[model samples]
Target: MTKTIVNSWNEWDPLRHVIVGRADDCHIPPAEPALDAKVPEDSDMRGQWGRRPQDTIDRANELLDGFAALLEGRGIRVDRPTPIDHAQPATTPDFHTDSQFGCMPPRDVLLTVGSEILEATMSYRCRWFEYLNYRPLMQRYFEEDPRFRHESAPKPRLTDADYHPDYLSDKIGNAKRLEWAAAKHFVTTEEEPLFDAADVLRFGRDLVVQHGFTTNLKGIEWLRRHFPDHRVHAVNFPGDPYPIHIDATFTPLRPGLILNNPQRRLPDAQRQMFERNGWDIVDAAQPAHNSPPPLCYSSTWLSMNVLVLDPKTVCVEASEVYQMEQMDKLGMNVIPVALRDAYAFGGGLHCCTADVYREGQCEDYFP
Candidate 1:
């Protein structure tokens, strides 16, 4: 048997290996039901669909390369995915998309658990084939680690029935969106199991998932059945009008600490587990920027989407001054990384990377 290489139970263990995403051949996908619902009514990307600007792609690559190098400098092994031409359309019997989104954020495509790497059944039609970009790495892990379990979730049909027609209108204001969110009426319907890997947060024996636009109640149920050994909890942040992924909303920094977006507080009903476990859920500092970088799908709360290197060290965006100060006050060694240019491609530190190996066994943090 080969040496163990694929293993990670939680997000904050000491990092030994990781996969950082690339910004090459990224695209703004054509508007679709579930995706369009998340786009703010006035967003610049409302109707645009094409390859991203060449200059912006180049700049983003530079930052990503520098980030990989920075990880190498700290003695952490970093791997990168082979980019596929996102210009090709994804055609299936049930659906067809004109173009595909890029692999700029590996977190949305791959979920890492103890001894396993599960490819997510992403909700968007444009992202159906995104897992191809990481196939090479998966093959490598399978060959090198005898214990590595490379798994893929069941592919969702993603037909028209998968989306709720109520969210298809472009005129739905933020107030209306918030009301819908509060009522747990997300864009994705309960027709199928649909989820993005970014919607899940692993804490040893517990997997916390967000029930939002990219993930439906059925998706959470699927996760619960799939990982029978772990406690799967479905959480909702009704305050976020455009709730997508959980990284920007609820971030677990260490064993007993979590930085939650102030605007998207976890409801009291959902706080029982954490509070009972003696955890401290602190409101994250405000983002330094008023708006996200151009053509970005995520909000400025990416400021809280930090990458935890062990429990004492974290990498924060260089421009997020308030976030840095907060991390410092919380007794973290903050490493400033310049990654705002790449925000247009996908997300921040945590969003752009996926875990391969962290230096620890699965220890139940909530038990």
Candidate 2:
């Protein structure tokens, strides 16, 4: 009999809970009493909530650990922590370690170097250019073919911020705009920015074919390399000022089932990719008046930042975001954790944490 191993958040064993590697500068400043008063309006994505750095860290850790505990409570076994050294130069071994956000397909384990970590850095070079870890994960994959290539191309030219601040809440409105403008300025600046005009036009013509967000490229590549056989789906960003990550509109709960807002248009051709694979795609409907744009805040707000505790359960921030009364109709258990500060860092639970591997799934060598 085939063992149908269900990798659900709820079924995860807390004893196996571990952080794969540590990012040097990813931690928030320790919450302090006086620092609360010093919250810069620029960085103060957290409005009204006056938690200091330590408080923020404590709160984030509480939620992270709590989620792990929830998994442990469910008898799921987690793995030991893996340490990734950030002190080493990004290119010392594989120059692309810093930007792993969307490189791989989602939820796949990679066998790179002892430092098998990889990420995509932006340049006029190859679009899918990759920076592999020092040790190299799969020598076979590397030796097999040149999936990633380097090309000599001109850097992209950026454009002024086209996204207006119309939909943001009063508190984060100005800050979000500033952030978007800053990103736009950099991308359209004299030097290499996040995007350029020609690049932007190309990306818009076909969001799936376009490449942006170097950090997310890391995640994308990881998914691709690790789960080579899995069917991957990404949404088209018809809107401007690129969404931060793929999770912006698409997140998988089970193999084929995903939770997504309807604003993201998945053409029939793309939808068929899942259906043809014997996967069932479920759409988490949006509110009658609710729409996603200007960075699809729902991607972040809906606790899309949260991660799956199990195939049927998820852990999210205990805030208005997850308070959607209509979610119960979807038939999944929601666990809420306090993550206000973490959410401010442009990520929440899922964003901050990376799922290294799923338990009980052994991948055999195909090639």
After superposing candidate 1, which stretches have Cα over 4 Å from the reference? 1-4
Model 2: ten consecutive residues of lowest lDDT: 196-205
What lDDT score belongs to each candidate, Candidate 1 first?
0.94, 0.34
Best by TM-score: 1
How high is the lDDT of residue 318 in model 2? 65
Model 2 spans with C-alpha error above 4 angstroms: 1-54, 77-211, 215-235, 275-299, 320-327, 357-367
Instruction: Score every model by TM-score.
Output: 0.98, 0.48
165-226 per-residue lDDT for model 2 (tens digits): 23222343444534553343211122232321111100101222223332223333433344
Give the Cα-based TM-score of candidate 1 against the true structure.
Answer: 0.98
Error of 2 at 299 (Å): 6.3
Error of 1 at 259 (Å): 0.4
Pairs that clash in candidate 1: none
Alpha-carbon RMSD to native, per candidate: 1.3, 11.5
Q: Score residue 134 of candidate 1 by CA lDDT.
A: 98
